[model samples]
Target: MITIYDWFGYELPIKERYQLIKKVGFDGVLLWWSEGFGRNYYRDAPQIVREAGLFIENIHTPVQNQNHLWLDNLDGESLTDCYLQCVADCAEFEIPTMVVHLPSEDNPYNTLGLNRIKRIAEKAEQLGINVAFENLRNLANLAYVLKQVDSLRIGFCYDCGHHYHYYPDDDLLSMYGSRLMALHLHDIGGSYSQHQLPFDGPINWAAAMKKIAEKNYSGATAIEAMNWDYKHLSAEKFLQEAFERAKRLEALRLYNP
Candidate 1:
């Protein structure tokens, strides 16, 4: 199925966003599981999306202060608790997967982070949910955390934009494709992590999709593109373009050999 993120740089009401997503021919949506946008929206988004007939693919946890998971302080401990709550929130909402980032910028991996991730994973396992750790600037930290936390609930969320901008040469799909549970498909060009629609940037979609198919990934073709660069278009027009790009990506993934 094809899915798009709910907040693609739109400031419309939450219900209107989901309706537009459904109206634009998307089968599902990726939600942000945080109150950073708004507390009522966070609490009501799952039902709102479902009412619009779009199944939620996954919910991305808050990224702010994610680096604290590695530090040796109360903040790290607090972060762990926050993640644990996120896992529970997934279960509460019946969302299957929760996407997370290991560290922001260049934070080093540490035992504290691993332990906290383990705690979050344990809760997810008990609640029958998946915790998908996403790739960021720190590849070593992602590698280390996935290796250290050996759980069925623990897996990877591949962000193609981050891959292209941060470590384009690294064959990340070949490395963690087996554990890939979710996707954050977007493009980057001219700047850092622009999150542009596919083909809008210079990323080789043919090559990326080929690698993803080679890994035997068969999950939702989900786009995390934002409207930062395409603000001139109306919301419906933006979603129409996103839906078309997603179909193009799926075609590449299926037809590439």
Candidate 2:
């Protein structure tokens, strides 16, 4: 069965986040750095996720850490060292993939991010973790990053919404199915909004997912949504709806297995 890790940022407390995630009906929770999952978060979250019959494990950057990991002209050895540390920490349990983002598109020439990713991939190989590269706002930018980091451990986290933002059509996604490690499933207009739902927005995700399955893209299909109207729908309630949403998507026959 497919699962969604209710994207709970640093806005709410851990206990509150866990409670809501369970109420929402998801069997997984993707925690970010900003969500206060440092030493304390790491220690406490595992138990809670297990208690709820959910898996607790995910990678996210801190607010100070920049959601966009700007891996440009930095000491390669040191950056790699730090990434190795993070991977080891996640290896404690309930972790299988490290979701990451790219740097600025203006200077696409920089290989810093690629080098760091390679280092992390190497480290992950030892820790038994996968490094999932997210498709940024620009496809060209992501393509360049992809061109640089050519490793089996370092794979793509296709953002269906981004494809729609640039342009719609299954053809756009067909080109990268071979590299899919995970998917940041969301919807976009014919423009740039990182997060939205397929039914709520304009991106043709049903088509994109079709290619993902056909290609046998064996990886996590994570719903990387950021927006939340916790007013009418609390995190607990929302999480439940999210699972149903995934069920509907599956019934759509996007993924063959």
The models' CA-based lDDT, in order, is 0.89, 0.60
Off by over 4 Å in 1: 38-40, 190-193
Candidate 1 per-residue lDDT over residues 117-222, each given as its tens digit:
8888889999999999999887998899888889999999999998988998999988999999999999997344569999988899999999888888889999
Model 2 global lDDT (CA atoms, 0 to 1) = 0.60
**What residue pairs clash in candidate 1, if any at all?**
none
TM-score of model number 1: 0.96
Error of 1 at 52 (Å): 0.3
Worst 10 residues of 1 by lDDT: 34-43
Q: Name the regions of candidate 2 deviating beyond 4 angstroms.
A: 8-13, 34-43, 62-82, 111-113, 166-172, 189-194, 227-230, 254-257
Clashing residue pairs, backbone N/CA/C < 3 A, model 2:
24-236, 24-239, 24-240, 25-240
Error of 1 at 168 (Å): 0.9
lDDT for model 1, on a 0 to 1 scale?
0.89
C-alpha lDDT of residue 177 in model 2: 67
